[model samples]
Target: MISACHQCGEPIPPRSDDIQLCRHCQQSPPAFDRTHAAFAYTFPINQLIPAIKYNRRPEALGWLSLVFAQMLEDRIDSPPELLLPVPLHPWRALKRGFNQAGLIAGELGRHLRLPVHQGLIRKRRATASQAGLDRSTRSANLFGSFRLTGTIPAHVALIDDVMTTGSTAQELARLLKGAGAQRVEVWVLARTPTKG
Candidate 1:
């Protein structure tokens, strides 16, 4: 079985319990209070998520959304009143033709019966791709990249396909909390495994 941290959803370290945070999450707690994810970002998942993002295949995530929703149904006692998909910069959205997070949020909304609010959180800056960056670089790159375009609910969830370093989630959750969100949770299809 693949066990995960209750806090960040990263795979629990060997011999560790699931109720604790991973080392990284403990050292630098994420801005979001909790993370809900279905699987680790490995094997077929690593391949499938990239294809869904780069290949414009939102349809491929349908089954994954349903499965994650099932997990959410069992785990979430207090669900978010709204869902916000991490937005892309206008230029990035134009180039990609869609935001994968938005698509994933939409699918998840239907399965989880939450209202997905897009355009509420806008990516105003077009920073370089975060693929090869370290944690600090990734955090700096996202600084001031996001803008709140609309009001937010007190309790809300940020929906995305993957949670890698949690940099993006940290930035967005900070933004949301700053904008009056009392509780912020993250829901994702997969979370990257920790490097030993």
Candidate 2:
């Protein structure tokens, strides 16, 4: 069963009351209108993300994209006008040899028959890894890191490999909204559970 926060889509424990939104999302709304994660960032799925990201297993991206696409098909009623992959700093992209998010977005675009716009946004600078940072620090680190290039569609989906605290997605969504995107949705392969 997909019992999760109504806004962020983070998995929630089953309960009697029909509480939809998570406490954090209720207190402070995210820039994205909604989020959909294919799987919980746990156990085997967590291992797969690192393998595709750090281990340079570009071949695994196809499988991951298929899984995420199926999840999106099940959750979203309609496809967004455009797919915007969360960008990587140029330097980081060079070091990594590929942007995993971009690859996944391309695959998903092909499957969903939507346009994937790679150059719509660029990472302005490299920042510290958000692996161990708290929510506030993560938000600060990503501040002003994204720059929108040209016109953005009214509806766009921000694609990413995984969402931990959602700080990165939130930052990018804010930028997209500022650039005239009326509605932004976050689509990710997985979502790491957060502490309540």
Candidate 3:
């Protein structure tokens, strides 16, 4: 496979320095150091992710996380000390009956033998749906929306179902790094080209 963005996992052209990074990453680096995506948020994945999120079909995450684990086996020479899932607001979690990111993190933890820490971060307030929002709006909406509930590990990975514009990852990672996390990586099931 060709090299991908070191920050967001989007494919990038080969360069003289051979840095596996996209122009966007070079211009404005994300808070997370690296990203690992199992699939693009397209076609079947677009459909499967909704079933797992809205339709309460967790089995899909099970299978997907397993595949993601298998894929990571080769890429991850050294695993992080902990797995932190992108959290949902209490109201959202209560209404949805579950946090998809938490579920994915649980499955990944079980397979990869990593510790899952859902309590490290908490969504402090509810925000509008990010589904159709622009990047600036999304960032503004999430500002100060999450707070740290516990200590953060120096080396950790953020787990989630999908990465749209990475606004959530940016917000969470920025918070984690500020709170003492040294190496923060993002592991998502899929990454969409457009912000979702």
Candidate 4:
């Protein structure tokens, strides 16, 4: 839980008490419909995640899932029809023991009492990471990379660990929309602020 504004140092009421945004977020709305981040991607979280992913710390997913579920409790309407984790290239999935986002989504589904659907796939060839790319380039990197397989209900919530440029979500949403999905919204664990 955030006790004060990250940028301005103003006091922030607990999410349960009052507030969706600190003064900063109020001034600048996020790109997603309603962004919900359990904690900023800094310090322990940033360090711990890489260690967990690289060192095979599967237990961390449990804690991450619990925090993400609590943060999203108020925003999402009764369990989404489906929960879809952003897909990773097959090679990446192989390199990493497991898809962190998928693990998080699975835990979230369990907590929220929803079905976790793993029907979507990364159809495009693997490309460079999005860490250093501009918004346009980020979109280009993810373009045509995702395709839905099997059955997908009309409404599904996309899940990811961090939402930065939002290009990944945008592209995925575009594909889902094209495939007759009625509506698609992203539910990420973190939404990074725009940096100039």
Ranking by lDDT: 2, 3, 1, 4
**Candidate 4 per-residue C-alpha lDDT over 13-60 given as tens digits, one digit per residue, 9 for 90 to 100:** 556655645665578533334344576666777777768878988788
Question: For model 1, how does the per-residue alpha-carbon lDDT over 1-196 read when each residue is reduced to its tens digit?
Answer: 1667767888875664444677777787878999988888889999999898889787887888888888889989998999999888888888888888888889888988889988899888799988878878999999989999788899999988888888999999999999999999998988988676
Give the candidate number with the greatest TM-score.
2
Candidate 4 has an lDDT of 0.70
Q: Model 2, 123-169: lDDT tens per residue?
A: 99999999889989999999999898899989999999888889998
In Å, residue 83's CA in model 2 sits off its true spot by 0.3
Q: In candidate 3, which residue pairs get closer than 3 Å at backbone N, Cα or C atoms, i.e. clash?
A: none
Give candidate 3's error at residue 141 in angstroms.
0.8
How displaced is residue 27 in candidate 4, in Å?
14
Q: Which stretches of candidate 1 lie over 4 Å from their true place?
A: 14-19
TM-score of candidate 1 relative to the true fold: 0.93
C-alpha RMSD for every candidate: 1.7, 1.4, 2.0, 5.0
Better model by lDDT: candidate 3 vs candidate 4: 3
Clashing pairs in 1: none
TM-score of 3: 0.94
lDDT of 2 at 89: 94
Model 1 scores worst on lDDT over the 10 consecutive residues at 13-22
Estimate the overall C-alpha local distance difference test score of candidate 3: 0.88
lDDT, each prediction: 0.86, 0.88, 0.88, 0.70
